[model samples]
Target: MSSETTYAVEFAKTSRAKCKKCSDIIEIGDIKILTTTTGGRFDVTQSFHPKCYTLPRKFAGTVDDFVDETLRDTTEGQILPKERDALVEAIKTSSSATKKSNKAPGSASSADAIIEKIKAMVDDGENEPQTKKAKRDDHYSSNEFVAAYRVYQKEKNDELKDVLKWNRQFVSGTKNYLLVKVLDGHVNGRLARCQLCQGGRLKIDEKNCSIVLCNGQFDEDAQQRIPCTFQCSIEDAPRWKPWFTEEPSEEEKEKMDKLEADATGEGAGDSHGDLASMKKEAASLEWNLSNKEGIRSATEDAIGLLKKYNAKLPEDATKAKQKIGPVILAHKRETPEDIIAALWKEVGKQLSNEEKEQKDKALEKTTKVDANAKLVAAFQELSEYYSKEANQRAVFTYSKCLNAIRGLDYEITAENAMSLSKGKTKVEGIGTAFAQKIKEFCETGTMQKLEEKRADHA
Candidate 1:
């Protein structure tokens, strides 16, 4: 046997390609794993689908170690249980065969010797071990609001134990203000709606110790005495700073103290407290909203509205339908009039467009076009604009979305867009956040952030 061994592993998000291992088609937008092996006089590059990738003999560790080290950069299509099992079995089979072959050469090699031989074959000067970094779950950098909200939700559901995951979630000194966070899910770059009065968008006061505030009518003086619904930011939140571990400055401490004081102070009186109590109890009270009869009636109403406006019920609306009960309960409404009123309001918002536009070049850029086309164009635009090393993550995400949409075999209408936008969609590479953008594109015919990007790039 030669003293050389293979030393490289790589992966990429790319267009359709055939898998070298199985001769099966790796569809467009799929993640492809590739490996490079170079011996004394031979070098080969092998490509495989994630599931098809085998444990390489030239690598330095076990199958699990290989996955952690080589595939750390991959964002989609992680190895599953079946694949891991298959890879492990295949590795054992190969090892047995290699020993048998070596036995004929009057050679006996220990496992450690073989491992050392393989490790030494890599050209260390060319391939440096990549330092592992924490994955950025908050793509839009909502100041960890997305992650914090997830923690808050899990706590609300009585999840057995809280698991601190994201680095941002470890942000110190967050004053958890009890603002009803509207637009609670992904809709990144879009402001959270103030659930109290819908007066203004919710914002994180990064400068004020992670307090939440209603941009519409927040008064800092009234924060402690009344339910001013002000948002706050977490002071000394973890970031890529030179001295991030340093404690908060005296001025920062003052801000945190003020924000904490506001969160516990009694404002908005008993009514506010009652509403908070109701919200806490909203999930537990079984006021009969998920019943078949109730669902049937609501479905009928929804279908009628769809028909009246020549619209169709989105597949994603199932969750929204389930939420109908909670929505009514959250508002503390028990009467039929109150429930029906709430239902109609939501229906009307979805069905009607409150904006009008005239024909013009600028209008064309901002006007609603086919949802699919808009999404593809928006992603492409983003990719081109963020074509730098620092922006690779953003570019990769946008490109993945564009490819996913292009691979869609059916028409991308508003209904389909709405359905795809739901967090539950099973599309590869596209998650809840991307889906929210797709939904926004379909609903508004244009995304405000994408257009802003266009202007900036132009």
Candidate 2:
């Protein structure tokens, strides 16, 4: 054994960097290395939990682009060491080039500009890296009116909160205002039917969400509210920022103040209410409960773990079916084709004659529950048996599982890679010059676009 040691490091999404110490996922800047120290034990390199890393990842796009471009400049002799140092200092101190005082030409508003950039990025097509739209509560159902109406019959003139289910849920302070919110499992999917379309008979757009609107006229000098007009700098929310910021009602604010006072002892002044403390607490509490444990009961754990593989279920099934499908596929990809054929043959027996035709391959086996269960059990049992033989065999099984997961996701990318990336089934009109377009292709969409163009000219 040698006292000297070397280590390998990798940068990862905060989601990937789970702190070994606290089991909280590490974020970008607040990342930790899963390192073995002098004692040869695993340790997390983060002093602050995953939450503080949230803010850094907010500017991750800018930071990464700047770092790469800066380093490239250093190599190209376009940037001096002094300039590089200044750039680093600027990044260290999060300086915002606030355009509050001056809006760019052709821009409607600063926030509109951010949204436009996001929209432009999307139009660039399937292959381009995309961030989801900033979520907002864009729609409302009349359920509240019905609920409030029920209560109104009982107490036509009751104080707020006493109005049964109404509880004066309507926001106060700003009259003639619309508070924007993300559709975070809020509102009924059925009530979202477009009132102007199909006489509002359909439940929803199904393809896209509806914009929720709240309209009211207060008796005390009726005022109307519009959409939330606050703007953002990025094309999307900072990964550190929660999906939405809520305007606390006067009552909620008083409650929060009272709780903070109680915790700090009235008049002790919110000394513990520091921003740093708030950041760390937010990160630690996110993974407060383990989905991993809750999943173990009904084969849900297996399905949950598959998410770690980046696999999605395009079909409907039970937890066992979903778990078993991937497990069997893992086994098939690793084992001999003849053995897999044999397994499918056994699986084919339980299916109807019509489905039996589909039973010649691994895909066919998964369509039937008994066959799926049999295949998964077979693989799991094989993995366990292999583990008994040697650590080397166990390693092979683990690799097979991972490989199967990757293979499926890659297949999906390749099939739709070109169209998804470019929104075209074939690439045309672009010449040898455009051929340079694919020096860095990642998804299947990009591949398809190239293959079509390449084949055309080849």
Candidate 3:
């Protein structure tokens, strides 16, 4: 065996890589053979499915010698003796078939003959009657259909039109009309009627792929439609239960009633414009300039109304009070009109500030998530590597650190890495070793330990 070429047997961690021999996907958690060929500076690695793997013709060794030489030290006791024996048998069978095929060109080998026999058996089974299998639609319940309908209703008008066009239905209609047409096609189509009617007065129109009532009645009529009395033979429930719409819950009904009341202005006393009314009243007040007492009384009334308006808006109330306080104290120097104008200006400024703050917070949160995503991915790779090596303690430690990083509320940047990892408010589960790795990643965008692991595996 050459020292430049080495192999290891392990289960694949992902389904993204293809098998070198068969050119098929090596599915996740399936046994695979990893082949590493050392070059000048880098190592190239290839993976192959267990059954597709073949021993090198140059290697003159027994099956046990090959297995012992290929497997890594960390995976020595992990693979069972029976699994090794199975692998050895598979390699021998593959080698024997190759030699037989080479000796007799254009002739079927033993493996090929066995495969043909299996295929013929499958063909014979296909010629016989098969038990009917349930459909994907039949598995869904009435609530599930209602949920899907709700999602359909929430789609954009263009999306709804596309769905209708794909289903070969009329697409020129309002959103609600399109939705109803699609729903009708699914619920009242030929298959639904055939399943529910059970050979009743309904005839299938093969050309149109539709079902029509034999009594010349339309399916739109409540009584003429498939009767609700039809029972399902499989579950002893209504055969068309999945087509039925679910009724609104109490909370949904209450929300609908509240919307109706607001639209009609019924039992909704001044809740809509109370603040505007108060502001208008304060602005419209007439104070006699000659009478100081009357001006004082008018000022007090205006202030009271402004306070009432502030009370109605809890989110802006505190800021509004701060703005109104100065105006209230300066009532003796400023006129009522000036006082009211100043208070409104302050309210506008506060609202603008709040909006800006909200936008900044949203941007910050987005940046934090992007940064954390990279860190989490790196940690996950390390965790997976440790898991494959059967280092349970390292896997657990890395998993805990990854979770702590994900739970962080702020982004860990190069400038804040030290504070987050070693300062007073250091993150939990991140010890000295993990913190060093995190700091290195934040500064260099890669961890040395992770790179070394990849190089070794390669």
Candidate 4:
């Protein structure tokens, strides 16, 4: 693709301007006229300061293909009045050829699709609809999907990291290997490096490839390697490819390298800021019906758990029965804890031994952080198993687990909890009142059983 020597530098428009090729904004001052093949069509022209005009750079698509220097270095006094005609003619000729190529049936529909997608821009205040299109308020939402994706990205990025360094030996009789750099974070294996005095990153240099790691004097750390650290270099370093697997031009490669480098620091050639922002913008990601089906399939397992465990109901149990679904649904609609409570509350005890075993297995998959508390709470709620003292222990356990997870920076969500628990087994849906009640119960922790049982047990 053709490149821009200077950015098109958009200016705020005073009023709209219409041209044959297109109708768009016209600003107060057009400091430079961006050089384009379309000549003065103004419609397709890139408005810029004339001083910035030059031929667009070619983009080949690798990390080292292009570099931007001074305009004077490429084109200076070549700006005689006649020079404009030549540049414009060249642009028109090139653009027309591209148009013709794009129109060819065998050659260009795929290219057009990519071009259109890239060119898509929402007008200010307009939002593009996301796939599933629904947003989570409490964000306990599709915690399952998020969990799945984190795994997916981790696996995906695991395929690309390869930085190695070697250190020189001070004594001629001692050792003779270059230190190659490695990483421990999997994604960021390249952090601080040290000289061979301690641990060293080492790699074998092939005949005539690129050279990022150089043989250097030993003093301090510059890079490290895998054998010493948990994080290791990726066995194979493959080229980065677009989704379509198109090989980028040298210029494109350089662009990518710059962007990646900007995202990573000198010691670490990784980038995360842009990707994070994109994920934040794409937060509306959701799964389709298959996930819902999986949830349904897990119910028999949950039912078994209910059957094995002895059950008890409070004096107000009938009220819970009537309002449980709605309370749970409300909590599911609001907080994560309620979802677990509803799940725990709904299934009645009536299982065969095998059924109970299956339910336990299901709980393993659903064993998420939020669910852990709910499990303990559910256990404690059954006054038979939990003496007043056991109930207090339950509260302490829940608090400790939550604190520990937060300290370790792990997500504590119903879905993840459920996934970790019994094994993805859960009722299809929790209704509004049921979810709400669970949420209210967790928040208040003022259920009567604890107080009454406290006196009975003590």
For this target, which candidate reaches the highest lDDT against the unseen true structure?
3
All candidates' lDDT scores? 0.42, 0.30, 0.52, 0.31
Task: Give the Cα-based TM-score of candidate 4 against the true structure.
Answer: 0.16
Ranking by lDDT: 3, 1, 4, 2
lDDT accuracy of residue 40 in candidate 4: 38
Error of 2 at 79 (Å): 14
- Arranged by TM-score with the best first, the candidates are 3, 1, 4, 2
- Models, CA RMSD each: 21.7, 27.1, 22.4, 27.9
Question: Which 10 consecutive positions of candidate 4 have the poorest summed lDDT?
Answer: 171-180
TM-score of 3: 0.25
Give the residue spans of candidate 3 off by over 4 A: 1-7, 10-140, 143-271, 286-303, 310-458
Give the per-residue lDDT of model 4 (tens digit) for 1-458. Answer: 44333333223243443222233444453322332343333434445333322334363332112112222212344345365444445444555565566575332112222122212321111133452233222111223323322333232222222112111111111011111111112222323221211123222222211112212122222232112111112222212223211244677657655633432222121232322332333244231213545333333332322223332223353333433334333443432233333444443223436544533442322223323343433322332223223354544443333223222223334334333223343222322332333344455654344456543532
Q: List, residue by residue over 1-458, the lDDT tens digit for candidate 1.
A: 55543323233455455678678876655555665556546676666665655556566677667655654434344556565565556545655665676665222122223222223323222123341122222222232433334444334311211121111122222222121121122222223233322223444443432234444334342332112222223121111211111245667555444432322221221223432332343334344445657645644553443344333233345544554545454543364434444444343222122212111211222222432444565655555555522365676677677656755666566666656654666677677787777777778877777777755532
lDDT by residue (1-458, candidate 2, tens digit) is: 23422222233445665654357666664322232335335442442232221223334465435444422231345445565454455444433432332444233322233224334433544232232222121222233322322332232222322221121132232110111111211222112111111011111112122322212111211232111111111111111111112354677656545543432222121333322332333333222122434223323433333333223332344533543443444443232322222223222112234323322232222222322222222333333333333444453543353223222322322234334224443234222222222222322223343344333322
Output the number of the TM-score-best candidate: 3
**Ten-residue region with minimum lDDT total, candidate 3:** 228-237
Query: Model 2 compared with the native: what TM-score?
Result: 0.16
By lDDT, is 3 or 4 better?
3
lDDT of candidate 3 over 1-458, digit per residue (tens) = 33487788876778998999889999887777888888647788898776777778877886567767855523546667787787777777767777776775232212233223324434444233341121122322233334345456567777766655443334665454455444443454312222121223222222221122221212331233222111112222112222213344567556544543432223132335644565567567766544657655654565566555543222344443444454556564566556665554333211234434533332222222545766776776676566556676887788678667766777788676666666688888888788778889989989999987765443
